[model samples]
Structures are given as structure tokens and as C-alpha cells.
Target: MDARWLILADDLTGAADCAIAFRRRGRAAAVIWGETAWDEEVPVLSYDADSRGLAEAAAAQRHAALLQRFHTAGRRLFKKIDSTLRGHPAAEIAATLAPLRAVHGHAFGILAPAFPGTGRTTVDGRVRVGGRPLEDTEVWRRDHRYETAELGAMLATAGLASRVLPLETVRGAGLAGALAEAASVPDRIAVCDAETDDDLSRIAEAGLAMDAAPFFIGSAGLAHALAASAPPQGLDPVRIGPDGRGALFVVGSMADISRAGARRLVAEGAVLHLPVTPHTLLADADGRAGLAAQVAERLAAGGDVLVEIVLAGEPDMSLGLRLAHALADALASVAGEIGALAATGGETAAALLTRLEIRGIHLADEIEPGVSLGLTLGRFSIPIATKAGAFGDADSLVRIRDRLRKARTEGSLT
Candidate 1:
């Protein structure tokens, strides 16, 4: 019960979803950025490296630096990667194992990015999303760093030795022994196959029984299994904040899932859509102010507002970062009026939080699979929910908005 775990992720949503795995299990979990101080009482610490959009070398470097500071004794390490293999998993895995090898004399990383609840599974060492090969998915076609969907090949490209533990081995009774045998070899990483949460739980049981310090690499599914395997500490119940006057929903992703969710919200009449174009955000300061005033007035009138970055035709992917920051800056003027915040994409959430001078978040619960609900820690201490751009369905946003509304009606403010 005294053991601690650190979940390091490439983005904010990844960090929160994984950290919530522990928080939901009666453990104190927090998601923080930079070298900000963490409460020692919390058993789980998830940090966002914010390297998903960076170059391979830069992403690896960022992971290496963060591991140097957080990879301390008595704490288990979990490297949270994208379930669709969108980020630099191979390079980041290498960086995560470096410190372990230096300190423990041997390092074994188990990579299993399967979230069955969300239709992401690993079989034969290849990642699949919604029954299709990852490469065939819209997310991959739009942006993917891997040449192949095979986990072994991806690791091999990064100059790391990897082996696949087939599903038969994963579900067998000898799983613990097989895992121990795999860990005996130095610098060897295994991409374990999993199709269900039970399979992931079996993997967690085996990995936790190993004598050496094992490094975990996966998405929220594996994190949930590992968290469940830990002994309960009887932590305090997490408090969900009550709704303020109204809610502010920010959508900055072009992913199909996010777009659908925005459209669903509009259809349900749950939120008033306030679309701002990139040109106005970048070139027109007064136009930005006008948009902010409109949003604030809506919030003051007790109406939920959904502000999205609108684009005509196909979007230029290169303008994503600039547009995210511009939109976030323009929205900061109404930070005080934002009673509750819901952001769709990681970059948008990070930028908006930075502009609002918020340092960290204490995760309370999960609104749905891959969507996390929490309260901000620093200056803007309000209720917030974060969701990955492509993780949820159309009804996901409506569900989140309804939860915040219920919390307000029930007077659950902490």
C-alpha cells in the first residue's frame, strides 16, 4: 500500500486518463507539468512531457530529462503512449529504459497499448483500432510517425531489441514465469498481446511479480490493470466541484471524433457554438476581443458556450500549434467567467491552462473511457474535464456537459 507509481505521458489527456486509473481506485493521483512541486501524500504522479508534436529527437530528449528527475527508487514507472501509436513510442521507450539500465544494471520494458473499452487492441504484436490496422485509420492517414503497425518493427527501428508475447502466452498460467524469463535479458523489451482488460490484468500481475524494476509502456487500459493490482490504501474520496454560473467548452482539434462531438452538442442545443477563424485569431485583435465578450455574455446569462476554431475546406496541419495558442490566448480574457471548463484536445487544454496560470490538476474521476474529470489546482481552481481529440464518440461531449450540470445541481462543489 506504500508503493508509489509515476505515469509519464506525451500529452495532457494521456496523463490524466492514466492517472485517473489510480484516482478511481481510492488512491491520491495528480497530473502536473514541468518541475512543479507534487504533494507527497499522493501515491500516483502523472506528468505531461508535452512532446507528442515534437520531432523524434526532441521527444526522446524530453522524455529522458523527465525520467532523470522522476525515476527515483521505490516508485514504479509507467510510460503512457498513444493507443494508436501516434507518438514516438520507440524513441520514448528507449529514453525511459536508459535510467533504469544505469541504476538497476538491467531494464525490461513491457509495451502493451491496448484499451479494450475503446476498441484498441494488440494482437500478433500489431496495434489495431476499431478492428482495423492502425495504419488504415483516419488518425494514422492524417498523421503517423511509424512506417508500420508492427510493434516489433517500430522498436527495431529505434535500435532496441523487442519480442512479442503472443496472446496464448499472455492468457496462460505460466505468464508470470514467462515474463520473469523475458526480464532476465538486459535491454530487452516485450510487446505483450492483449485483447481485453482481463488480459491486461494478467500481464500486470505477471509484471508486478518480477524481481527487477520493470518499466511499463502503454495507454490507459494497462494503467487501469496495474492500478487495480495494487493494494488498496483507503484514500479520501475525491471531491467534484459544483458548476459555477455556466460552462465553457473549447474544441481545437480537427479529428473526426472531436468534430462529431461538437456537432452533437450543437444538435442537442446543450451549447451555443461560437466559431472563430484562424485568420481573425492571428490578424484581428479586436475581433478576438469581440469573440471573448460574446462568450462572457453567454456565460453570464447562464448558458453553456462551445467555442471552436473553424476552418474552411481542408486544414493546413502545420498551422495547428499556432492556432491553438492564438485561440487559447483569445479565450483567456474570460477565464474568471469560466465556471467549468471542457477542452477536447491536449494542446488546446495545455495552452488554455497555461494562459489561465493553472499549475496542476487533482483527478477526481472519469466521465467516460478516455475522458477525465478533475479540479484545477493553482490560480484557476475550477472544475475541468479533458478528452483526447480522437478518443471519444459523438455523445461523449454531451455526457461530460451533463455530468458538470448534475454536479452543480447536487451542490457537489468541493
Candidate 2:
């Protein structure tokens, strides 16, 4: 309930841990690790940043040690990614971020650890990934889990305890529905784990929607996804697609599971933008919203539209609300009691239900940290399966997509 300053960073866990470590005595703050900037819409814990190591160092070499881990993270996440990832982490000059250096190159997994406390120590200056020197290009390309480790270390040093929650447990359960018992806040933000730079852009969209509620999106994976269905953005060369649709999330990534899964989501209507606010996703659409307007027009024309939303990105809850509003508006004219709505994608189902206020829900599984997908079927009287940005393999999407398609055709409400 204090004046908490939410810091949008490459990793929310690091941000949270940093807040704990860098506390200035009177401030009450915390971090909500996310999959991407867009997934911030769902506060459900199914989605979690791989905050394995992030603790402020008690030793003088703490910051330097962080740089070493950063190198490995770069390799894990960005190293194996194609040249054009939509939500890749922000470009970090190796020389500026780490210590050992060669020809300076870019790193996708940079921690946005806020300089908390009364005094200030900035990380923006170019540093190197320490430990035996190497050229800039030699720095690890994409390592997401390394970022988690950094967060864990920082949290430990900051004297904060972290608990992992399984988001899958709350599937089909709306935020206000079963979780009403959880420590409630006026607003909660979810972000894509991010594997690209533009993945962080959802912060702008989320900021507009949440207003003063306080939230943002960003992460080591370098991308963000709107939990409500929407397309992937920031695709290279293509900018906006031939359909005039813009490419979404252009981050570097080495995670085969996230890469393949999110790509498919971006192609289907599952990834379309959903906004949130008291008024819904369009909390800020002033008729000038190009993408929303375009999607709306297509829907109004009675066109069979399917939007693909990236669950891996972990967008902000505020943005998810906006995205939900869009999808709901698309279905606004539906006169049916709804034969059976099939919800898929990480936070998509949950964001939609929560935004729609579908009530009566219960978690079927225990919450697991870093695991996406929650399942619940009650209250709302409909089956809801939500993803939280953790997919083990590329085939994961194919399986889920198959299940969703089958459910749609077979009327499998369970």
C-alpha cells in the first residue's frame, strides 16, 4: 500500500530483488517476474521469469560477478536465435556491460536493476562480461536462465525471499473470481519474458492502460506478448506485413520451445492484442488506434478472423486487459449463450475471463515456479486453460493447438 515504484526492466525478478536489496527504508516495493512485456495482463503466478540468480553481492565484486552470469545468459537466449527475433532483449554493448571484451557486440539479456536506495550506482555504463577476456562477439548471445540466477543472487543479497507459483493451477479462474482471496491490488501487470527488443514496447501500451496503477513489461528473453490474441510485431525487413499488419516482438532467443511456440501463436488470432482497464483493453483507444481499428473493421465486415497471441512474451496485465477488450469487442455481437469457448495460449484464457468477469473458479494443481499453464473449471462454468510462458519444447504449441481445435469442433467443455 506504499508508494511503490514499479521498474520496467529486462527481468522483473531482478527488478523485484533489486527493490528488496536497494530499499531506502521507507519504501515498500516488489517485483513481478514475467514471461514478456505483453503477458503482464495476468497476475497469475503460472508465468515466472527464470530468476535463478540475482542477489546484490555482499562482496565488492558482486556487480562484476553479475556480468559473468550475463555472458552465459546471452548464450542461452540469444546465441541460437535467428537474426530477427521480435521481442529480443534491448541491445547491450558488451564492453559497457561486461568486463572481458573483444570487438564490442550486443547482448539480449541485460538486467534492468534499478538503482535503489538514497545513493546511486548506475549500470547503464558499458561494462564487460568478466572471466578470462574475449572479443565482444564472443560474449554469450542468449541465455535467459542466467538472468534468473542473477535475480536470485540479488534477492539473496537484498535479504528478500522469493516464492515460485504455478500459474497453471488457476486456469479458468478469473482474477476476481477464485483469487479474490489472494492479496489483492487495484491492478497487476504481466510482461512477456522477452527475447527481443520490441518485446519491451508493451510497457508503453500497458502504461497507457493502467494509468496510475503502476506497472510495466520487459525481460531477458527480449519480447512481450499481449495475453489477448494479437500478432507478433518487430519482424525484420517486413516491418508491417503485406496486409499492413506490423511485425511484433523482435528479440533474440535460443529457446527452441519459446521460439516455435510463440511464432505459431503470433500467426493465429490467439495472439491478437487485448487491452485492460476499468473500461477494458481499449482503455486508451482514441479511434486512432491503427491495429485495433483494423482488427475491428475486419471483424465488423463479418470476416472469419483468427488472431495469434504470443504467450511466451509474458505481456503486462494492463495490456492484456486492452487485448481482451479487443477480442470481446470482436465478439460483442455474439448473441449465443456460448456453446463452449475454447481458450488457449499462456495468459490469454485467464486475461479474457478476468476481463469478462467470468466467475467461480478453483485451481486444480499446485503452483509451480517457472511453469506456465493453469487449469480451472468452475464458477465461470467453463473450462479455462491458461499459459504462463513456460513451454518445454516447440511441439508444446502443436499439442495445445490441437487440443484447442479439437475442443472447438467436439464441444469438449471440460
167 Cα displacement, candidate 1 (Å): 0.7
Candidate 1 per-residue lDDT, tens place, 57-101, comes to 999999988978877776888999999887788899988777876
lDDT of 2: 0.28
Best by lDDT: 1
TM-scores of the models, in the given order?
A: 0.96, 0.30
lDDT of each: 0.87, 0.28
The Cα error of candidate 1 at residue 195, in Å, is 0.8
TM-score top scorer? 1
Model 2 quality (TM-score): 0.30
Tens-place lDDT digits, model 2, residues 207-266: 223322222222222122222112322211101111212211111122344556656654
Error at 58, model 2, angstroms: 26
